[model samples]
Target: MTWHGRPSRGPSASVRLDLREPARRARPAVPHLPHLTASAIATWRARMLNEHGSARVFEGLARQFEGAGFEAHLVEEVRGFADEERRHGVLCGAVVEALGGEALTEAPVGEAYPEHADDATPLESALRNMLSICCLSETVAVALIGAERIEMPAGELRDLLTQIYADEVGHSRFGWRMLDALSQRLDDEIKERLGDYLEVAFAHLEEHELAHLPEGSLPPPEGVVYGLCSGPDARGLFFDTVEQVIVPGLERHGIPARRAWMRRHGGAGLS
Candidate 1:
């Protein structure tokens, strides 16, 4: 799945996404109990907004790749990834609706741009964005989804989580594949520069507060069984994913883990 250079034709020509059947099969056999409280509905709405934002970011990345003269296959793959994200948004919206929450009709505020990208070269910015959104964010997403899945009882909610998890795994791998391919052309200095951006990207992610749960609180039975975790559990998942999955994956791809940055930020950083 590595792309050394541009391909003669794009994947859009041959690749198509059949989202309907899987989505249909993944639907819950029995109706979900409408036990969601106002707070819970709000939370689900927020998640729907996040998924919408993710779809937009992926769409932006696809355009960025095309404009930067990346391989046609890679560009098309990213485009397909954008479609997947959009589908994820729809799925999340369905959950929100089922929980008695309205779909977020408006687009989420702000946009996805890498920290320090303003002054970076176009290729550098693209790489940084790739690492942030695909590598870091999607990897965290997989872990979070897994945590939620564990607490979720067997039902439509768990089924939905499974579907989303599978897509996220592929999305994370897409980032690694691109990084591996790009490594062949990028010099050590440039790769190191890209690696440095990981710290900034991670900091930005924390600042955005994408999924922070409260400290020392027990997991809410209602939310946990419905694909949500407690504050403490969410925070634990974020850090664990970074240390266990993200750092090692980056290191394997020749990207530094920026352990110093992590240590300066908190305890037992990434050893």
Candidate 2:
């Protein structure tokens, strides 16, 4: 009844940042906007601060995965993610630095994992962590990406988003696929528990901090969901994948593929 791909185990060796396609480069700064455009500056800086904090949380959670006896590959992915975020922070800060500033060193994520993780049995702790990553954060991530596209029309901003949307689909898929894998081992009792967990997690994403970025932006509102969520082509691809592939895949493992979940969560399986 937990989220998937935040795998507990993976290799411990250092990971190289070699992507078949390189990670997006540090973008050339726009010459106009005279001085630091305060709105864009604050919006981006605030977001990067959150990213650094989320990365820290992921780093800690990765260790917890190791302690729980998951494979080394999970640790390796975690390390890789941590490194990528560090680089993201660096690249993002370059823009700030261009304006004569530096990103704050690193900020801690404001929340704490629940007591169930510390005091409960293995199954319970695992469920807690999974719920935290997959249901809560991953869902929020997708929404934010969609929202950012609508609000920030800057080329650099759009480019950054393209990279995130591509990578994050995989992360979400991992968590969801993991959950489907788990459903195979359980009875209906567990299914109900999982359904409840997903329910609450989705509800959390509905709250204020996550609903969208604070309203103002540079290019004016392009409608609520960037081109991705709000457009036909992207929506078609998202729905086609969910209906044709992800939902079918989950159904194979005895997980219910509620059409509502797909629309709300997107084809959230391993994209």
Candidate 3:
């Protein structure tokens, strides 16, 4: 199945999420139902769908890890990541209902995962996806959610954001640690291929973030209480995370990540 990129299916493609849980578990308390505007309800509903999509992505990554002969522990961790994303979906779905929105969304299509390059080896292919999903995407999630958590009032919404933030940190760390674990196998050829793929990955990252996080708009204080944030803040945090965190992390592993990022857009970074 495709690991990322859900093509738009319009409203006809919408499906209601199953929110029933047989096993009882304590869920985060959501205390702001009255504060949730229609816009916030829509945003949380979209987040529920996004979490579900992320679960599918991690499921594919788990299979990729296992097929590539990665350590059992690492494969297990990826599987756990999938489960966590599913949990996040459920959590977000509950919040959607609490905020007076239906937990319905367009389902993503299933297909073979895309290759980073035609001639890329299996290990290279897996690493490229990992770098995209975990290193860049999840890392940016940590930054964005962390900022949101701090700005949010000490309430159930903040508590929920904290939980998600912690999971994202683990996901981000897994990418870098897995890279370290496979360091010996990253021969010069593989490093070069990964470097080349970084350009493509960075480009995709920019497109994805720009589409998800708009620019020049900040949620009002009331909106922040409902877990909203500034689009411009998110955009700036994304580039800062890329430059300060991801580039340096990749460079430490002998990948020409900075160079690849510079090449991501005609040697001029995003405005």
Candidate 4:
């Protein structure tokens, strides 16, 4: 998935900048300086970039909500998530700094969100994106982050993880709740359309996640202290979240999530 509804970056799109969060509170102590490595520091820096990018994604989602004619209050709530994601980015950047890495990253060029389909209705388009963004992606995020948080000991890193995890839970719930609200109006046809899109959505989700989460041996014990995790471990958790949590949750709403998942292949069912 594409991040929908982001504004164009125009002329200065590729500028490199420190994506750090402005300090709104005291900086948390950075533990495990002795455990730091180039790779680990890079990981934290990458997280900083990812979190900042999420802001743009959420901003697009907010616009989709508006286009779908969701309630004004709920649309505004979705809009607010952009700021929260920016805060998470800043927090991750701080950790990178504390680890002696710069939070500088190239601003993504052509910052535009895509319309999932040319023929889909505004509501169908919104449903497709929301399910992909929040239900699948954010739900997986909640599980992965929560797992890392549990492995962490008391410290700034753990605290940061906790904050992010809570927000992710909210993000995931927003999609589910939105679905519930729209359920009465979904009708059989709309529900079938959504089920059809699930195959494509699940395929994209798997491809994107697997690319980022490597298949490898676990990280050393100290890596966990710095919020690092084994690629294999994270991959396992991601699949588990999709199968056990996301699929079942969607099925409850009369979606054929299991069938879609089983039949999923890259780009299937997309127009």
How far in Å is the alpha carbon of 240 misplaced in model 2? 15
Q: Clash pairs of candidate 1?
A: 213-231, 214-231
Per-residue alpha-carbon lDDT of candidate 3 for residues 115-167, written as tens digits (9 for 90 to 100): 54477766778898999889889988888878777888897667776777788
RMSD of 3: 3.7
Tell me how candidate 1 scores on lDDT. Answer: 0.64
Computed on alpha carbons, the lDDT of every model, listed in order, comes to 0.64, 0.47, 0.74, 0.76
**Candidate 2, poorest ten consecutive residues by summed lDDT:** 1-10
Q: Tell me which of candidates 2 and 4 scores higher on lDDT.
A: 4
Q: Work out the TM-score per prediction.
A: 0.78, 0.60, 0.87, 0.88
Instruction: Give candidate 3 misplaced runs (Cα > 4 Å).
Output: 1-16, 20-36, 115-117, 266-271
List model 4 lDDT by residue over 131-237, tens digit each.
98999999888888888889988887788778878888899899999888777778888878888888888888887777777786456887778777888888888
Overlapping backbone residue pairs in candidate 4 total 0
lDDT of 2 by residue, 182-250 (tens): 666767765555444544444443332322322232233332222212233333433344456544654
CA RMSD, predictions in order: 9.3, 10.2, 3.7, 4.7
**Each model's total of backbone clashes:** 2, 15, 0, 0
Give the per-residue lDDT of model 1 (tens digit) for 154-242.
87777876887888889888988888877778878887777666667777766544324546545357666665467666776677777
